[model samples]
Target: MDAVNLEEQAARQQLFTTLYQKVFPAVAKYVSKCGGSFDEAKDVFQDALISYYEKSHTADVTINSSEGAYIYGTARYLWIKRYKQGSQTKQLDDSSAYSIIAETEAAPSEDKLLHFLETAGKRCMELLRSFYYDNLPMTRVAQLFGFSGVRSATVQKYKCIEKVRDTVKQKALTYEDFLE
Candidate 1:
């Protein structure tokens, strides 16, 4: 019985691999067509892969739905999320109102800055997030994060901000020269 179950798992794995190989490029194309670059498409595709994994692991898991359909649906949802987040102007439409709450919580620049801060270092990320996103005072942040005092916290926060700024500048440079 164990051997049979193992064989079945292997078969399912192979099937999933085949489906991903067949569908990813198509989803990428769809993402690019919808105002996203290849990198963004790749990110969306990665998210969709996680979504697919979660769906596949469910107790009611069945292959009755086409894998392509599942992935495409997830990719579409991701792309829509990306679009709503990127757009500056708010125009309410009935269909999208349910998802708008999550999208409106942060500006895109703040999101990118947060992502950069996260990539910098855990300590820096925590310090910056505590100060900025959580709106904590320097003394409070220092006490919470074990910094020596408010001045030290202030300096650490400045350094973290500089690191985040540098990361953003570097990323922006890849697209266009910031000085020009």
Candidate 2:
């Protein structure tokens, strides 16, 4: 009813639209790939989105990666949390269980990747971040990044990945640097 409330509502709508167009479907796919169903994926993504939004609203909240990357990371965290809470305590595969636990507890790597992307073109960095790091749906990402559709986004994402991969490879040319 109030002007401030209306503005906030509009902002919320914009956020939802941006997320719906940029976030959801990719996360759903990742969830499904990791042995979750569509319904489960939806639930997980919804919780992740809520957490992301809350974090976003906080002062000086700087996302070192694309919004998609942030969402994916959050979704993965929420999914792991849900799994821990669920009664499926029986181990399915021991190695997988270990890897999953390791990944879930690892520290964030956004800032490091972001610094790499910064030297790359802004558009390329955005595309790479959304697709590879964030795991956003190609369909929506294509539209957001000015591609024709999902197909283009997919191809572009592949190319961008290659670029990043190449960059990493080049940087790692010396084995001594990587040695502890």
Candidate 3:
């Protein structure tokens, strides 16, 4: 039993060493092209290697690609995940500051804009809400709205936007006339 365990360990070590040599350069190059530092690339690659090790050990999980390709892909995915998380946090911090200022200055205009959207009719409101506020993909929006396909849903979205724009312009002019 000890002999078998030792042999398995040695085999695993050899596999990892070969994978590191073949895959690390490609992963590092990809990370560099994606604006990550060498240290970040190394960190992500290490995590990827660990993930690959875990997955490879599982009986039900079959890797369809070569070990190097799998490792490189995992590294690329990890780097993108890390990059998105950092950028999202940064954006939230920046947007919090801007939201405070915009709320105070734009309250009246925001109300007027809401009124214009309300006048645009309920179906248009639902369509826009599904696509923008809910962040559903065009295909899902099409499914929700019973559109023929993604192309139709996209076309309708733009038309709805144009309708809202025209409505806002016309209402603003009338509102200005009323104030006078």
Candidate 4:
């Protein structure tokens, strides 16, 4: 049993080493292009590897792409999330920024939008919220919504968006009148 465990550990280590070599450079380049530092790239890449490992080990989740591609994609997503959070924090800390942002907006009230969406039906609201607001991947959204696959979830998302669009058009409201 110890021998088997040692072999498994060795194999996992080799796999990760190979993945880091093959994947890290591209992830680093992407992060750099997105204005992240090398340390941030490395941190996000490590997080991506952990995410990939967890998802791969899950019985219901399947990675459809090459391992490097999956890791790179995950790293990109992590970096974007981190960057957005950082920017939002910075924005919140700058007091004068709020007034400038407020001056630029003329849109339907959140209450009105929520009421319209609520009228669109519960399932549409949940589906839109999961995909857009929660930023869930299509596969996870599919699983959560009991969809057969990603394609179905994607189609359903389009349909829900169209439903909202149609409602907006029926009311003779321009898209900009919604929200920015």
| Top lDDT model | 4
Ranking by TM-score: 4, 3, 2, 1
Cα lDDT tens digits for candidate 2, 11-120: 99998788967888888888888788999998988888887888888897876777788888999888887877775776569898888887677645666666556656
Steric overlap count per candidate: 0, 2, 0, 0
lDDT of 3 by residue, 37-123 (tens): 989988988999999999999999999998888888889888989999998777556778888777565444555556677676888
Model 2: pairs clashing at backbone N, Cα or C within 3 Å: 68-134, 69-134
- Give the TM-score comparing model 4 with the true structure, all chains together: 0.51
Residue 22 local lDDT, model 1: 85
Off by over 4 Å in 1: 1-16, 60-64, 89-180
Cα RMSD of all models vs. native, in order, equals 17.8, 17.4, 11.1, 11.8
Which of the two, 2 or 3, has more lDDT?
Answer: 3
Each model's TM-score? 0.40, 0.46, 0.49, 0.51
Runs in model 3 with CA error above 4 Å? 91-180
lDDT of 1 by residue, 47-97 (tens): 887788778879897656777888878888988988888885667798688
* Model 4 stretches with alpha carbons more than 4 Å out: 91-180
Give the Å shift of residue 24 in candidate 4. 0.2
Q: Which of the predicted structures, 3 or 4, would earn the higher TM-score when compared with the native?
A: 4
In order, the Cα lDDT scores of the candidates are 0.79, 0.79, 0.84, 0.89
Q: After superposition, how far is residue 164 of candidate 3 from its true place, in Å?
A: 35
